[model samples]
Target chain A: MHPAPSVIFFSVLSGAGFGLLTLLGFGARATSQGWPAFVFFAVGFVLAVGGLLSATLHLANPKNAIYSFSQWRTSWLSREGISAVAALSLMGLYAALIIFFDIRVAPLGYVAGALCLFTVFTTAMIYTQIKAVPRWHQPLATPALFLSYALTGGALLAGAVAHAGFLFLLTALIQLWHWNGGDKAFRNAGTNMNTATGLKGAVRQFESPHTGDNYLLKEMVYVVGRKHAFKLRIIALLFAALIPSFMMLGEVKHLGALIAVALYFTGTFASRWLFFAEAEHVVGLYYGKR
Target chain B: MTALPETTQTKLGLVIDLDTCVGCHACVVSCKGWNTENYGAPLSDMDPYGQAEGTFLNRVHSYEVVPDLGTAQTVHFPKSCLHCEDAPCVTVCPTGASYKRTEDGIVLVNEDACMGCGLCAWACPYGARELDQAAGVMKKCTLCVDRIYNENLPEEDREPACVRTCPAGARHFGDLGDPDSDVSQLVAERGGIDLMPEQGTKPTNKYLPPRPKDTLDTDIDVLGPLLAPVAEQPKGFLGWLDRALEKL
Candidate 1:
């Protein structure tokens, strides 16, 4: 709601990190030999979970963050926290299963991957659950976050996959689709606001309600120049979806994997920034002209 | 076990009618006036001359609802604490300052117990609880607890100030816990809806449905029929001068 870039980056970056780790964990067990896969899994998992935990520490009162787990029955914030912790624990246990029991417990990789998928689902739900934010309200938002995690994780997993090269390419394409959908959601949100505010019709008369700036005006209502926002959206679309997609399918298969991963991650970061910035909170209507 | 008093039940709440509300903000002004003296800390404005800042318990917000019609209608929604049955604010309070009463389901803050931690504010979805800067305590709509129970005040005048001063009769104060109360009956008849009900706050305060102006169902032709026409002739010197100028 604050539209803080730090928070937006924290969620998207950590989400991809979690997605990458969860896939690596699953790949480890799917493989015949477990040592190389375990290395990738451990690195990805730590980067994802550690980043999230560090970001959460910046909260003014981290002690109350514990109570965030209590409202899982209703609140998506609670559900996200719960699933994140659960996914982390499951990944840790999966690692233990590999170390202690050899490759025998490799099937647990599936469990860890499932848990990670669910974790991202809950994370996506955190944004989707908020009705006030029309941009985040789309049905596409959940799946886009879901697929971004998969593509990000799959790209990381592509480095570990011994034979299935197509999986990586497929995942990249899915990520591209997700990015397109997310961009459309932002567009739809803008259009919805224009319609709701009566800015869409032929003759538009706009008059603001507040005589002076208020808290809602300061926090919720953000004014982004149309030309600048359009340019940014194009940049985000190229970085997040198109370039990564092309690289993933390019001639140099081995090199393409690395390029795709880099492009996807960078694009996701930009896209995530756009996600928060482009969103217009309906509460802003109170300040907007009648 | 001590028996609960049948008549002295406490968790007071207000139900507001969006349909009847004229959006005068009398309730907001009255709330500020009453709470300024009674509450532990008064709402303060840091730079009233320069920046215009002050805290208030009640603020009225206006919204536009577009129906299947040619024009969009305005609906005013007044925001305040709903005193939820399952208050996330209470659960998130580490210092035990925010607590819900089992007696009346009203969530309240104990100023003495508060450590100035703002967890409860973030936990609230409705944006009801606000931090009081001067006293370093959280303040909210108390359902006018002091006024409602004051024995010195006459029975007719004992209700919350917002309800008493509402010239539009949009505000209703009563026990929502009782099925037969005036507030409950109003809610039932109007099919009141909660703001963001998906948040699962179970807010006690409900908003009545918006009424349509088309419901008047009157004929414009019938009202205007047979009205005498107004004269359009110039009088005295102006009339004669106009005729002379035309002739010249």
Candidate 2:
């Protein structure tokens, strides 16, 4: 149920990117925020398109991605696909509305934000509905994805507001801590043999059910060493937790904020990859040896 | 000639017994043999000699259960698609490749429509559906639908390949909706149970409860306990510790 990094990045990045673009699309028409509007609009469009292409690459049959939109009534995946496409289309229309009609609709910004947030929810629910992948079923994944969107969006917003003053750094710092805390929750609700095997109070033992490897083991169990995990945990904490704090505090150079963004994206992508690799699907039971 | 009125209801399913099953896996082999030949594509084996890679519709798993300390008994559970009333797999299929008949509860796949997304397999808790790597489509137990409904087949032999070929007579096939059906009556008399009842799948197939070889009614000898010493231990550091623990 753990989507590939390409998928997770596609959701978190595009969601926040679209959300910010929608806000910018509305901002362009408002006489009050004219100069600032172009900045948000440019960045939003770049991130949205970039993230969408990244997501599309993960599909085995990209042409059939269009078919995914047809089953919204029964599938959250279809709902997510439809909403993402709709959100993108609306953003385009909003831009046209501002350019041609010279219309300034504040409610459009709110609607776009709502759509972006719903995309994130649908993305998270896709994993939550899975019965075998219990790690994704924890209460943590939904909130974690939501807060990640907010923090990522907020960081970009703070960078945008730097032209006004240094004041927005405080908000960015607070959001950074919130994002990292959610990441910790995601890591701590670790899936273990006790849950996977359903042994209860008894000790569960296994004799190599298969003589050789199969698909489940190859896909699910990554050969993540303890040393490597510890090392990566440090990296995740440093980027997601510490560097952002330093950047906001002005303890580092102004360019450090950009470094923080790079670090956060790289660290989160690695963590997401590990999340999928580390999770032991119960189907492993058919072939597992313990 | 005028057309006959169509029956409003048809219920298709399987019945499995827990008590009589010997865990031989004959049904598993028969199912694989029948489905591979009849389905969209044969269940291919990638490395037949080097590794096990063929697709299977049914698998017999063995579980050991102990009722008492005397001995443990092996429970053979043959699992496949349960054809549940609330099948999430059918609902989640985007291409309409997966569907459940309203007339009969049988969930089926249209191989031509399946894009090989592998979503239906994830939705199934029983691990019933498997991807046929060669065909690039999902496959599973059809309850021998082709054979069961074939008019050319003998009336006595019309059933799933697995049920018809079972050496132990462990599997039965019938309509549970009718209370008088043999499978239904047997289930009522034996007190069958569903695996993982909390899932709420409402599986049409029922497993007759396995009766343990031993029971809790075994008599305990009284003489061993009566012969044990009640007096204090020999006086030492160990004795003092033992006395202190006993005093509590």
Candidate 3:
């Protein structure tokens, strides 16, 4: 869990886009197929597609990503990739129908919205399903991620001021619950030095595997001081949850909504960074990191 | 291809003897030398002369185990791929790149299909899978697949390089699925235990713990023989004879 920047950005930005789309979809009945609809559609597409493309930055061969879709039968990453494509395509078509045909199909919009949420869920599952990463491998990870999207995207939409405020507060509570619970999560996973080396008695590393670093050490072994993490968590909470909730309550206008969106992005990014940094991969037991 | 079989035909893996391993790193080097040439990708070295970070399929580490005791001994632990029965690296793969062969239960990566996302490396608890940065691919111990099944090699040579090159005979490779196989028998006799059984990967590889050290006898005078002769040195007349005898 190196917490590659590209992945962190992708998750936050794309989740926002999908969240915005979901908001728009639900309001399709009241919202018109007019200029404002076109604008929301454009912004959501840009963020969504751009974020998806950015996710490939960590891939050694971005061109080979197409093959990833073929493994959806078992791989959560594959399911995420394929679902993102389907959600984008359907949502794009729905927007096009509104712009060109002067039509807003309710069923199509709802289907696209559901797919968007599913795509976000799959993205979270990419990490949550990993048994080796105990922090993410809990029932709480998906809820936290999905709720984060609702919090950020609802702020971006700003159409229903009262609803967004309510969602924002709920998301913040869920985020706190997930964070606190996840902190104490992986200790019971049962990975230890004794289990790693298969020795009955207490085992300790007397000598390192090498004098220099290796790929496993570089990629999986990361340490963040608890004090710094606590400070960052407060910042993440303020910006991601509390600040946005206050802004939505104070003013649901365009200016307030935009500011909330910006803060939510930054907040979620910080939280996402902590997500990877805090994750306790079982391999850490080998290096005595956990 | 990434889907694991309900049951593999034969579980081929390794058993390491912690008691006899001297930490000489012979198996590490031998595996590097043999596999660097045969595996789909060369075990490349970045700045071989400068920082000299070379990728090896096998690595050895030393550890100290204490049990409320005064003494300790260094135990050399060598690790490689365990080829787990429920190998998550294969199932979590976005592409069908990483896989375990159902026939012999040897896990491998199809270099052509690997996108090098490094998720497989993350799922492995043993720190076995490593990303080859230059090749843009993940690498692990192939169990010397090239040599093991090579028809051109002699029958006796059809074994993992690490096992064959181990001077202390600490590494053993064979079909672990068969109860009568040499490796299986050795595991049974030595009471071999799987690494990280709690993880439930059902790792095929096993390790034999180091044996206890012999207790020291404090009651018997250990330095008595050497000090006694000097203390009992004959008087001046006979001292010359003792000195002559010592010299002789």
Candidate 4:
């Protein structure tokens, strides 16, 4: 529930990067070989790889991160790491063939595109699988929203403004739905102080275990003021959805795409912050914080 | 390796009594003291003299419970890892660092493999795991794995430090898997309950609920007859003094 900056950035930037890679692998022509093609692919690689690297920043022990891919059979985070690496590697090879030798292996491109989307799904599952946070446990809440954002942002960067406009509007609706349902998720989770302590009565926390802050409080008991969150929601809708949707749909060509991309990133960043901040972890019930 | 074993050979856990825990937090201190020196890494304090933030495997919380038929009562709840049969913390570990031992059903974090991503802590509903800020690894109640199996220590000292240090004898350590075990029998007799059973983790540890209190009637004065006067008027010398005062 802590709106950690590194994780927020990682989610937003990597989602966008994978989205861009998906479009490039599927839509780009075999003859497309030059600085423009290189530049586009370069942007995708930087965003994806840079975002992945930023995730390591939050790790208290980064030295052991190499072993993270070992548990893919059961761990969503492990699957995510493996999926991202595989997607990136395959996409890298696909890009190299076209960029250097002008060879388009159509099948390779298709497979890479599918892998790109799968990587995003794995990333989304990392949050969705956590039943401790009821808001994120919903399939429509995290997985749908993440995929929608990635596609919309990807379309915009790929210069498919018309497609991007429609996707942006769809993503906005999903974001609204997520917020509407997430507000009641914790209360409806059937977890309270009574259930937490297994006491058959109206139980109230008389005293916490410690006098000062602990890791659980800092990590899982974030409180965002309702008024500030409301204001931020409006800002996110206007920039991430409304503004971009209007510009892209109207077919404004004079630097419109560039401006829309920038605004969309800012908007998604704000929403991503709320994603972590608004979530209520079940552990909060034990502390009488939920 | 993150996958849980089908069944553990033994379920070694604790049985805590809510009625007996006095909120003294001796168990918390004893656990911290023993774990810091013996475990994978020392439980470090960020600001010992100031804010005093530190890692602790076990903690005691006090709760005020107001029953429908009785007066409010204070209950001291000492919490640590329940070492659930289906431990989510183990499955959520990206590395094979977190595991539930099939031998004794103890959940442990391998400090050497832990990246300290804090995902295991997030997955735990009970807030059992804490990321040690100094060691940069996840830490939790190992159920004193080192002490329990060590042949060097005295036989009586084989239990967990918290169970050994509990002043009120509120804590009990034994195999909860066997139906005939002392802890299992205690659970059967006292109706020991699991914390958040709806979560369906099937926790190994059990908690005995506090007994009902304030059953006596407040309106009835049981001591009134004993304090009542022996005579309606003053006796002997006091009676003469009263008559003289009346004449005046």
* Cα RMSDs, all models: 9.4, 11.8, 5.3, 4.5
* Model 4, span A1-290: residue lDDT tens: 99999999999999999999998889743346866677778888898898899999999999999999999999999998998999999999989877887777888888888888888888888888887898888876789889988988888888877788899899999999998888888777787788899898899889999999999999998875544888889988988988999887686674988899999999999898888988889888778885
**What is candidate 1's CA lDDT for residue B82?**
84
Better by lDDT, candidate 4 or 2: 4
Relative to the true structure, candidate 1 reaches a TM of 0.65
Ranking of predictions according to lDDT: 4, 3, 1, 2
Winning candidate number (TM-score): 4
Retained true contacts (fraction), each candidate: 0.01, 0.14, 0.73, 0.86
Q: Total clashing residue pairs per candidate?
A: 2, 0, 0, 0
Off by over 4 Å in 2: A1-9, A12-16, A19-65, A96-105, A139-147, A150-154, A157-234, A251-254, A278-290, B1-11, B214-248
Candidate 1 regions exceeding 4 Å error are A28-39, A54-60, A96-104, A139-141, A157-215, A225-229, A250-259, B1-26, B29-55, B62-77, B81-158, B164-170, B175-248
Docking class of 1: incorrect
Residue-level lDDT of model 1, residues A1-290, one tens digit each, is 34565466567666766777566555643553366556666666766676676667545434445555655555555666777788788777776666556543556667777777777776676666554455566566455655564545454444543322444345446545654665565344443333332222232222333245544444455665433656665665666555654554445465666666666667666666666666655545434421
Model 4 TM: 0.94
* Per-residue error (Å), model 3, residue B46: 1.9
Residue B56 lDDT in model 3?
76
Scored against the true structure, residue A214 in model 1 reaches a CA lDDT of: 48
The most accurate candidate by lDDT is 4
Which CAPRI tier for candidate 4?
Answer: medium
User: For model 4, how big is the CA root-mean-square deviation?
Assistant: 4.5
lDDT of 3 by residue, A112-231 (tens): 988888888888888877878878878775556665655456445635667667777777787787787788777777777888887757788888878877787667777744447888
All candidates' lDDT scores?
0.62, 0.61, 0.82, 0.90
Give the clashing residue pairs of candidate 2, or none.
none
